[model samples]
Target: MGFDQYHEPPNELPDEVRTFARMILSLIEEAQAIDWYEQRMAVEKDKEAKAIMRNAQKEEFKHFGMDLEFLLRRKPQWREILQGILFQDGDIVEHGEEAEEAVD
Candidate 1:
């Protein structure tokens, strides 16, 4: 079987790199799940169904966060750049620009 998450052959990739790729795939899946729930909930007629979707979406959020944190721990540059952009008020693009420039 082939895995799209890996650019190189999985067997040739080191254990850590393979694990990172798996987590990246997991994060993407979780984000997709969250988006799917949002779309379903928006048009859902039943209040009970909407509530269930929202609860499921929250679990996806946690999974995404855990995946992101794991990746960031292994990539210092990523952690550095996001620190300037995430959870901060004001212009996001400007913060991203500043973060990128700071890394240089």
Candidate 2:
């Protein structure tokens, strides 16, 4: 299997860390799939083809959400940081800074 996700030696990492890395890669791949479908939908002239692409994109969104939730459950600090940034109406950068500060 591909171990391209790891910068460090996979053998040296704990099982949980390895799983985290795999999930992170899966999340990235899902996001890429979503983007690809979106681009294809934009250029696609056929209405039925665009509808299929949209359906596929929706699946990717579900996959991305599940992956994110799994990662958040694994890392409480990450959850805390995202809680400060996500679903908020204010400045995102400001929220990020605040989240970091809140963690400290």
Candidate 3:
């Protein structure tokens, strides 16, 4: 829902970890925008809207992929830690736990 819902308790993570989580959340926000644009393009037959959605979707994918790769390559441990924190209680947790174990 809101940013606060995504955040873990402050005591659970260091400043750096918190910052990285925020960065990932920002990427998610951008991704959501891309999705919104795509949906709008699908519903509307406007030429300009379609073009804008296409460009935005491509850019969003590029940015999202780059950010994910950066997290996986640069700070892998932190990435794993962040995943655990983000997904611990969600429906994704079971699948995520498998992925987390593989990373470990």
TM-score, every prediction: 0.95, 0.94, 0.59
Residue 37 miss distance in model 2 (angstroms): 0.7
Pitting candidate 2 against candidate 3, the one with the higher TM-score is 2
Q: What are the lDDT scores of the predictions, listed in order? A: 0.94, 0.95, 0.73
Error of 2 at 32 (Å): 0.4
Query: Clashing residue pairs in candidate 1, if any?
Result: none
Tens digits of lDDT, candidate 2, 1-104: 44789988888899999999999999999999999998999899999999999999999999999999999999999999999999999899999999999998
**Across residues 1-104, which tens digit of lDDT does each residue of candidate 1 receive?**
67988889888999999999999999999999999999999899999989989999999999999999999999999999999999999999999999989987
Q: What ranking emerges by lDDT with the best candidate at the front?
A: 2, 1, 3
Error of 3 at 65 (Å): 1.3
- lDDT by residue for model 3 over 1-104, one digit each (tens)? 34573456766778778777877886787788778877887897888878977888888888887777666676778677566656366567675666677677
**Clash totals in order:** 0, 0, 0
Winner of 1 and 2 under TM-score: 1
The list of candidate 1 runs beyond 4 A from truth reads none
Top candidate when judged by lDDT against the true structure = 2
Task: List residue ranges in candidate 2 displaced over 4 A.
Answer: none
